[model samples]
Target: METVQSQSKNSSTDHHDHGGIFGEKTELYFAIISGFFFFLGLILSKLTPLPEWTSHSCYIAAYFFGGYYTLLEAIVKTRKGEFEIDFLMIAAAIGAAYIDSWAEGALLLFLFSLGHALEHHALNKATKSIEALGELSPKTALVRKGSTTEVVAVEDLKIDDIIIVKPNSQISADGVVIKGSSSVDQSSITGESIPIDKTAIAPNTKLPKFEEIDSSNVVYTGTLNGDNIIEVKVLKLSKDTTISRLVKMVSEVETKKSPTQLQTKKFEKWFVPAVIIMVVALSFAHLVIEETVRESLYRAISVLVASSPCALAISTPSAVLSAIARAAKKGVLIKGGRALEDLGSLRVIAFDKTGTLTEGKPRLTNIIPINGFDKNEFLEMVLDVESLSNHPLARAISKDINSEYGIENKHRSSDIQAIQGKGIRARYNGGNVFIGNVEMMKDAKITVGSEIHQQMDELLQYGNTVMLVGYNETLIGLISVMDVPRKLASQTLARLKKIGIKQMIMLTGDHQRVGDSIAKQIGLTDAKGNLLPEDKVKAIEELQKNNTKVAMVGDGVNDAPAMAISTVGIAMGAAGSDVALETADVALMSDKIQSLPFVIGLSRESRRIIKQNLWISMGVVALLVPATIFGFANIGVAVAIHEGSTLVVVLNALRLLRYDLKE
Candidate 1:
């Protein structure tokens, strides 16, 4: 089977090829060439003692140089029965030329073409984050084949192939380290600035198994290696690497238009035809009123030039793309313009308990020994049995036992079994050992005394998950685990409220007391407890039914349904999980909750800019159309106003690229 490493490499190359088509150099070249001819035509017409016919020839040449590409695009679009801004500009220019105003026609085309070039340049700048990510993977890698290292193209390295990453070089593919250690920078993927220390595991040691690979042992594509040389066994192909998926997601986002963009497009369907009809009607009306043919045609052409919706067409995409790019730089991946627009309208945000608000790492908080059992010995036995389990609470207990009491998994326990939603059971030293919740103890016929029950209640009251340990039908001890709230939880809640989030709710499968405790601590507006996965989905549905736009944030597995049902699904710390990256509408690359507020602020700002651009574009057209009909505006002034409004809209959208959370 081909390894993920090989797939990742191939996909990376393909994504890079896709990105290559968007470079700004081509647009800059066209703009420069068009500007040069425009100046030459102006010099010939006004300053030089050239013949009138020669000046007119110069103007025609300027028009061809400035607008040939746009004219061809318009023709292609026309054949497809779609009318765009290019078609509008070309038609207006033709009308000006027919009115014996060749100079004005040439100038209008030059400005219109220049606007197209600038818009392309601005879009390129806005989507630079995706392009920058594509560039991070190195072209070649040092592969070790049977004790000999040879440089090979990254795409040529297959799964299980060993590659040596030298100091200061980007890792060519995603792999697990089999030899050496290094401090690697993963900011490109996770957005964390600090370098992480990674070490190779011993050959004989069984690595801890989890849903996601541990960051310390896994090296990903495009991450920079530090001073130490490390050998990695490639686990994923280039195309399937974390960076490749991230790049692909960012690229796909631009194609999904926002609500505002869709509205403008709907308006454009009839708006373009209306403008043409208006111009024709105005010209016929002027002729009926005994106006001269030349004067009647001039006013009609002015109306055509003045009514082009160039600014309106560009308003939403420019703002959305710029906002999306800004979010990416901060390690927040907004999947599309739809998510970007939806985020701004969210009145309620639902968060999953574990891994969203809480750190998700449980800790052993309390231990109560019973029946005169040796505290240390009981703890040691619990560690040995739990060592065979992969549950988060089991790992936390084992880690605590190892650290606090120097206990290790040395005992051989047979018949080990996991009880779903309850706990674990194993036969140790020919005695039945049970470690689980209150339900497990009851099922095993272990009687809990008042003292034991009181201890459990106190722990539950404090929001800790209590586990009972029994030996051969006798209650031995009580253990409590607590998954604490993240350090930034309260701060994140405060910022959300400050930014106009009307409600924040947390949903969890933990006991109601536990859920309420964490919710109170984090200042959540509401908390729902003991909810199954389906229950969470129902909660999200309830919020939506109230006409509240909701964003559901979670770790992206058990919460996937709930997130999918909401207006937007945001995955927290999604850098390690492909499912989370793909399933969520928005993925926070890092684990910092503060990024939530920052994203909200960005969305609100983008929405504001889109509104401003729309008003400006439509307002300009509204005022100029009437002025042209009354002869208050000429063709030159109309074209100037139209082109200037387009530029203003583009510049306004570009402001989102510089948006910062500190503002």
Candidate 2:
């Protein structure tokens, strides 16, 4: 029952906070200050001929200043029996000091602290998108209380409260418009750059309610309103807003470790103990061979510092964070390192028909009159009845009819009803008007003649969804609608093939012919249609049975279960729906198919960089440990090589930040 503020506070206090210990600035400040003292000590010891105690004092001071937090963390983790990179670095530095190499120890601490600071800064920058989203919604809302409007904190606003949003202001909560009209920029939520026009819904219409959130009548939190005042009745509280859910998802994503990262952690558990044993054995060997304690101890300390797996530990997370940030900037949200890695190895990708490859908005494509009926009269009647329904096809037909003939309803129909998955039924002009799929006609016992059936077949062949319109007992006409493929859908599929995807399939609930037609148009390798949500899940499982890694792309409530069962679930246009964002492992914030290619390419590159980093880290340790034992490298040189490799691996991962789809 914690409030949002308390939840945020607790999350910030967790170890994964982007800005650690006060903030990035404080970490940077301490690193710089400690580096100055370390350099001063180096100058006194090597160049100034100052008293040894003076230089020793300065080195001790530098070590404590630069490594205090790291030392504290090492102790805390050690007490909990979890030895990490901090423990390794601190142990190495202290071992150098134990061997009277104060200058080398001080320098090691300073460089390690600097690298930690830089890593934090880079990670914080990468996660800034989530913070930016959190800031988009207004903190206060103007509530319309009786005759006067009063400003109140968004958290205090309740469901069903009417809030007034002015032009250019961010919405305070998710709600439905009750009055006025405007174009709202929902880019923060849906990643659609174009502002969508929204108007008030008519009272008591058969149209789906605002809870389903039709774009024309629903306004979401964090969207910017255009130049018109609108009254919105809140549907959700501030904590339950779409933006809040999005931020929460982004924050939790980093905690889900990738397979590679988990493997690296497992290696480190064994690697750390082995390194300690090696250091002890090397110290014993050196003492027996050379019989000089100072040099023997120094060599062992150098081995400890050189063989630390800092780079290996950082490899996957740094690359994953950078890629996630890059993808976020382009309106793609990679849920975690696991999804990013899996995307690289996907052999097959299954896509839902609606809202993934195609624009979910259908348009009126054709109208056919039957039994010598007048086309315009049939259209007018169909529009009148369909206007009362909230189906996408109905809206498209109504829009086209309204635009073409300037038809306006003179009177409201009575007893309007929606037959789920079929059509609409209502009383118009003292007679019954039916508009829906062919199933509705069959259910009503209306006979469709051979010629009309032929016409319907022709429409279906072209991937059009045909709706039957009947007046009383006789069929009057047919309305055909099509949801067209996105402009870049074909190009995206081609790119996926070129990137080594072996199979691409379309799965849908639409008619088989309609699905096949769209699949062919988009150049998919295969298509499966007439699927219920469970059918799609079975289809995904069938694909996986062949040992193919599958990714399912969809954006609907029905798609959720199938998406969950797939190897990876990608939600399209997820910014619009909290459920979509939460349900999928990855989310395309914008309704753009092109982002698919970019994300896949980025994942492959991340995997490549991770492998390269691991090789470099293990190679350096393999070479330097033997070299330090055989008297080829000194303590200072070993520390330099180790910290430098860590920096190189980090910088290599940062390359993902500049990766672009256009490139």
Please list the C-alpha lDDT of all candidates, in the order they appear.
Answer: 0.73, 0.74
Instruction: Estimate, for each residue in 396-487, the C-alpha lDDT of model 2 and write its tens digit.
Output: 78898889778775554678886644768999889898887788988888888888888888888978877888888988888888878888
Best by TM-score: 2
Q: Which sections of candidate 2 miss by over 4 Å?
A: 1-86, 96-262, 309-318, 370-381, 388-393, 403-447, 458-464, 470-476, 509-514, 528-542, 545-547, 557-567, 574-576, 643-651, 660-663
| lDDT for position 75 in model 2 | 71
Residue-wise lDDT of candidate 1 within 1-663, one digit each (tens)?
Answer: 011111112222222223323353444455456667767777887898978787777677767766765676567667878775667778887887787667667766775565444434433321454555566678899999887889998878898798999988899988888898777865444432235567775686564432155667887787888767899988878887766765565455433444444554666577767887888888886547878777887788888867754565456666777898899999898865567878989889998877778876677888888899999878878988998875556778899889977877777677888765467899988899999888888999999888878888877887887889999989999888788888999998998998899999988766678788889888999999867456777899899885679998977334655665678888886422344444567889877778999998999999899889879987988999999999888876776776688789889999999998763
Please list all clashing residue pairs in model 2, or write none if there are none.
189-575
Q: Candidate 2: lDDT of 53?
A: 94
Name the regions of candidate 1 deviating beyond 4 angstroms. 1-266, 283-286, 289-298, 369-381, 388-392, 403-434, 437-447, 461-463, 470-476, 508-514, 529-538, 557-565, 573-580
Worst 10 residues of 2 by lDDT: 1-10
